[model samples]
Target: MMLVLLLLIYTSQHALAVVVEMNAGEMSVLLPCQFSGFIPDDPTVMWTRNDLVPKSVHVQHKEGDDFQGQNQRYRGRTKMRPDALDTSDFSLTLRKPEMTDSGNYTCSISGGRGERTLEDVELQIKDQQVEVKVVEGSDSVILPCKTKHDLPEDTRVEWTRSNPELMLVHIYPHKSDQRKKQDGLYRDRTAVNKDLLRTGDLSLTLKHPTERDSGGYICTIYRDKDILRQKVVLQVKGWFPPWATALLVLLVLFVVSGGLLFHFRHYFMSVYKVEVDSGVESVLLPCKTVAHLPEDVKVEWMDSDDKKVHVYQSSSDHSDEKHQVYRNRTEMKRNLLRTGDLSLTLKHPTNEDNSTYTCTVYNREGNILLKKDVLLAVRVPQVEVDSGVESVQLPLKTTLHLPEDAKIEWKDSDDDHLHVYEKRFDQLEQQDQVYKDRTKMNEDLLRTGDLSLTLKHPTDGDNRTYTCTVYSKEGNILLRKKLELKVKGRVQVQDQTGDIRNRSSSIDPTPLMADQSV
Candidate 1:
């Protein structure tokens, strides 16, 4: 229940509206209220919120500030100006403000018979953070920022970069925006829609983001005395930086000058170009080293920024200080580490992960041993399947030959087996109840890696994730692929979450196949 109580206090009186803005979880607040003119001896001042009972927030009496009759909730959390005659200052102070503390506050003063209201203040808190990602040297990057509350046309919006360098990125004050106060690097490379400000849009359009342009940006909005704030962190990936390219060219020259002596050694360095569909559920960034590692070897994997993505040592994973967003979603095959395979599996990757990942292998003595650079290229799949009643064959055929003793497992969104082929036989009894008899797989073609599954009748519930896991004779995970299953057999309908969909599709009798590009 909301507490709001007002008993006909307005009698042809104009109350001045003042807005005091701040984010939630603040330590304290000062509500401004003052009156000009003469005072009668020791004046009686009272600060109150109509919604709060007893109507007493703070009182200034001749005995020097009292709160004996004030509401207990705000008894010791409020303050007001003591000198009302000479300074004519009257403002309420609140401590430990929260989201629920946002509302209307009234300051009424009564002394020597006459009573009048001083000011009506409205305090607000803005709480939201936006993220933006861009490819280095891309055409432009747009940062979306909008406040739940509306802003006046003359509201001021200022953009500033808080990381790498503290500088003014852009500004719009006195009803118009200009680059005069903006940093020289961003003067001609930025623009914002002025008309959009009328609808609470403080979005900024940054043109042509370079390598140095990646960092945190702050957007401060001001209207009259009210203030709102937003923060955006932009990540720039891709593009060969000029410095790194030059160093690479120098390395080539150094190798050529030495009569191509290290040419043969280059063959030993492993490089993997892993590519996957943009919307895949997961992807593997392959990393391996032929050099034998000591038991206490420290392994580190990092992004282009040299930020630690994963770390391992002493036959265990140490993930401390890992980036907050990528903390728990990263893992490695600990069972295969002793054999020199240091592949990192990233779960639920987005476009931001479409960058270079450097795998650094270190010896027990902290000496650099081997470095493998894995370039991850993410793009939409080439084939597009339309959802309809027609049978859709999900094309998944591999060139690798499967041995007779190979193992394969097909799973749905729930990680339950939809189909399983192991020991040269089809095990339908091991499948989940939802796909008991509806799944079909050709066991005779198992030797040709034709482990595909076809659904007898696809339905709306089939629109979900499906994965295929293959293992070698040694029980090692040979390959894994995840695909999205959709259905369009029924009419378009909206679900309880307000999402409308027409889902239906058929898989080509083949089980899930590994993502093609990688």
Candidate 2:
């Protein structure tokens, strides 16, 4: 027995161990390296992937570094700090790491005698985030979170919202979620199907997400004490009255309305409604150039009062013109001159941020090129939804161009398949019984990246999550979005006399006869 114990101890001494795990697409990760004994000053350090033999990830000396025959996989990724050796640090840091870079990295330091093993760290990169955009007034929304692995029963999954408010979004303790401790804002508004969780899905279904429902959500899964995290940022855009401002803007800018439209060419202007989570995180106002401009072109964002939101001039930002309300709360995307993306970002938007702003692009000669009006709408999770229409249409539109053979599937809160569009046709046989003959889709729209679904005779039972997932023929998810539909109960009616009256419940208005439909 003593001999066996001694052998086990010997094996443990040289056993390979994974010291770190990280998510993919992270900015950077440091692989720690420390010599077991005999700390050498100004020693040479080399990091290599065990799988890729005869190739070093990084090579550094006391003076400089040389990567003559480094692997192409880590050509521009691996680097070492200049003052690393001064602090007995021989760690290798990888920048802009990808999921494909997962492997066992071996670090070694060379001294007067020879090379000494420092550490063998195994790096694991999780999947990149998937985006799912939902309109604010939707009855429900689906926050998709999943893992391809069938984890152990003791696996701990935590969903929390740290921005805007540090609230416990959801917690899946052991086998099931503990909802009693949930915040009052999300007590019954959140749900996770047990059957779907068993099949490796941790997606949460939320009911009645108003403008406030937009924010950054973090889903963390802990298995065997190793933590794997996925981040999802939800942008809940609200639908304001469009026609209310359309006629007014047209009258102010058109020739027929005592305004100038000829020389200014206001028709070239663009319009967008930006969604922001209330007190959640920063919001983005997307503004990009339709045509590239000069290197020193100027970009200005201002409100109606000519108050500058952000002004880029003289090759740098002019913070002198920044308003007091927006002090130190805005940032522009890096390298905008190269990418022609002139979007503006507002940090930690709150209800006070609901307003209109104008983004203008000017050439180096101060020539107006493009002007866009962006409306910032904040969304909050509310108890009610706007039930306006009679045969509700659960909007699920995608903006990405898809191939002819893309696989699209729409599912409900029950995890049942509601609609399946694949193989260049809609598979009616696989649709759930609740959706049969009531669902419709425009196959032509799918090719153009529009995946909006039309629901007929929508009832209160349909006030649930509707997730639409677009997949490639090779089973890769191309795009996915979730929307909610709520049926109108207390109908507000308008008759021919321009008389408006509110009707209680589903009862028809007195002006409508039994033979007439809504």
Candidate 3:
């Protein structure tokens, strides 16, 4: 019994500490160590790493902290509470932790009799992983690596490509603007922000990305002896973009034979094109067919990644099989089979929703019935208005008649309510203070189907993405649109009108698709 009790005490000491994981660019991390019970007179607390040279990370004695023997690598980057020994809490605070700081540390106390191990801490600092994808012939692409904390002034940022072959991409704070020491391939194609250290944005911009530019790039920020790194994997697609390739193929087919052009157009119709603003409430992926489907048919919608988006069968939605990302966010009409409409409504559509979706219908016998493809493109439109204009109108024209009890709201990207229209009238009490009396809407917006908001005295501070959302009486989202307002200084009113006119003209009014003979 005595030996077993000693073994349990030893096991508890090892189990007291835990593995701590953090990113390399984090501000700080804590390695916890605590001991309770009677105090040992003249005790000396030590935190040391076995693999590091000199080993000692931090030392606290009855006389106070003894840094005379601390490792040079961890001299000024570690700290402990002033009353740590009194409170029996000997936790170590590590500042600006980097990948090189990953190691196992042991905390032990030494007294007049001997020494006893308290706990062991395992730390792992990992590099952030970011994947960027873009098509060839693009004007530019940004590899993002940002931190909330501003780096030291003496820090230097280095961007390099490691895979395939080691090469220098870009470096900040160099003497020359041309970056003469950069690799030949990225000499003129690579650049970084002018004030990256101050802004904490160490992103690298590559111009006209091609297949050769696809590789793994690392952004390393060095300050004194500490180094932080983030890795980004870039993928550049085909020689020609998908849109350009499709247009070229269509032209060739039209020139070769009219019948071939017709066939290709039919195929194209099967693939619908849908474009919406990034912050829309939801978007519909239409898949309607006139042919009567089987009573026991199964409908499934899958994204480009082959993940299930929505599924329906036996006159009910099988939401249990949906992907986690789409859970509680997808809906389909109950009478889809009877009406031959198999549209899927995805809520809170974002830029990540920009993908090709496939809708397939299978009969009870497991034979395919119909298949359709939809490509969703979520975009943010820009609206430029002169700073000194009397009022600028954020235009939104829809033909659908909104519900009488629906609520129409205009909010900025900051989530501030700019204007609110509810219960058939403007709700001034709900308007944000900054936009209290500077906003207006059409008196009969719901009836006229013109839900535009006019803002008076546009200023540079008002330059932000504005979202207009209409909600039903049941709190269900009816419609949503996002518009980026750019308040330009010293610009003529005519140019602002031209900008709005051009943006309004760019709206596509054609039907998504027409019923065809199956």
Give the TM-score of each candidate.
0.35, 0.33, 0.37
Q: List pairs with backbone clashes in candidate 2.
A: 164-279, 211-379, 211-380, 212-379, 212-380, 213-380, 213-381
Model 2 accuracy (lDDT, Cα): 0.70
Q: lDDT score, residue 245, model 3?
A: 88
Model 3 / residue 511 / CA error / Å: 49
| Better by lDDT, candidate 3 or 2 | 3
Query: Judged by lDDT, which candidate is best?
Result: 3
Relative to the true structure, how large is the alpha-carbon lDDT of every model? 0.69, 0.70, 0.80
Q: What is the C-alpha RMSD, rounded to one decimal, of candidate 2?
A: 29.4
| lDDT per residue (tens digit) for residues 1-518 in model 1 | 12222323342122346777665544566777767766666578777777778767788876678878888877567876656545878777789876766777777777768877777877776465566777765668898777766677677888888565577888875234464456555655667786766677778888767656678787777766555666787888766566877886787767766857355444334556677764455689887653335455677888887788898887888878677656776899966544668899886565457778998877554666567888777653332344444444444456666677888888876888888888878888898898878777765766565666676566666776676767778865555555666564434445778787664434432233456321
What order do you get sorting by TM-score, best first? 3, 1, 2
Best by TM-score: 3
TM-score, candidate number 1: 0.35
As a whole number from 0 to 100, the lDDT of residue 256 in candidate 3 is 62
Stretches > 4 Å off in candidate 1: 1-22, 25-46, 53-96, 112-114, 135-140, 147-154, 159-169, 174-190, 196-200, 207-518
Error of 2 at 256 (Å): 13
Off by over 4 Å in 3: 1-272, 275-297, 304-309, 319-353, 361-372, 378-381, 491-518
